[model samples]
Target: IMRWNKNIRLSCAYLFRIKYNGKYLLVKGNRIDQYQPIGGVYKYYASFNELKTKLEIEDEEEINFYEEGDLRQITKGKYLEKFLDWFDTKKNREVTVIRELIEELHIGEISIEQLIKSMQIEYLKTVKEEIKFSKHFQVDELKIFNIYEVRIPDETLAEIINNDKYSLVEAGEINKLCFMKKGLSTKISETSKYII
Candidate 1:
């Protein structure tokens, strides 16, 4: 059970880094109302219910109805390394990035069916953020981000970036948590730096 004095978040996320014209593409976040990388939290499969129950993992209630079973959850701090170990096995979890990309980019089935050949996806880096007190959520956040570099054709990228829901930040302008708007000095998203 989550206690009032201590709250620990153990969650994993995968993010995509797409670049065009020296600018990286960032999409508006659903929960925080800020620009972030085109990605979401990993999800545990139904078969993991045994462990979920054992761990007393609670379903995410902050997001919409569809995000009921994502891999994001809060628990005791003692389960920190154990959670990452279970996640490294890559079993009983959503491992593919296709689902998130299709959801965030709104790609058609035809376009997605042929994406593998036209798109070059590779693991970029993994960032492990130490448990720290968050003033916004009023809890200690422990997060791991599996960042991937997704390379697509310039034409398709331009088309996707045209959407108002997306923002462009230059490579140099990216700070630890925020980035300046393309050709401007406006900053957005404190957590977007993880994608870099």
Candidate 2:
């Protein structure tokens, strides 16, 4: 079951899928009739550790599949809580707009080579780095202007979109679960300009 303080906002999940032609993303196809990722938000718990534990359990009960961890294998930086605090500006309220892009959607391990192949762009140089302009300003950067590639399998992407196995539920209330995936676009837009 999921639980959260009344003040805490729900986390959002966004799933990206490969195109049917096996090239580029299927931007127009997957958007809900309402538009965007087919998932919604649920309230957050008191602590990330607690939330992580509950997430694994919910994944099993809802999808019959258990994910090993709550946070994705992105390049490490500040704790998620800090990011939430910074974004929401309400210290008492924990609001995390989590983007759940599936690595399996691309098939094979996530590698620069795979991205290059999938993007279908010739490269002469590639760069992966943790951009840190200052102690507080930091971000994960993956550049493939040249000399790098990555391939994302279409079948893998389809499996995620077609399965309909995952549920976006609250951490404290299981009943909070529902099949809603619309609205709040301004709040959860893909671009970072809106985050501020």
- Regions more than 4 Å wrong, model 1: 1-6, 64-66, 107-110, 176-185
Question: For candidate 2, lDDT tens digit of each residue in 41-101?
Answer: 2233445455344333222122222233322212223233443343244332223222223
Task: Give RMSD to native, each candidate.
Answer: 3.5, 16.1
Query: TM-score for every candidate vs. truth?
Result: 0.84, 0.23
Tens digit of per-residue lDDT, candidate 1, span 1-196: 2443365876688889988887888887776667778887898889889877776666656655236678878866556556678889998898888788878775533366556567888998888887788675577888788999999888777767777788888755567456555554554565567666
Q: Alpha carbon lDDT of residue 176, candidate 1?
A: 44
Residue 186's lDDT within candidate 2 is 17
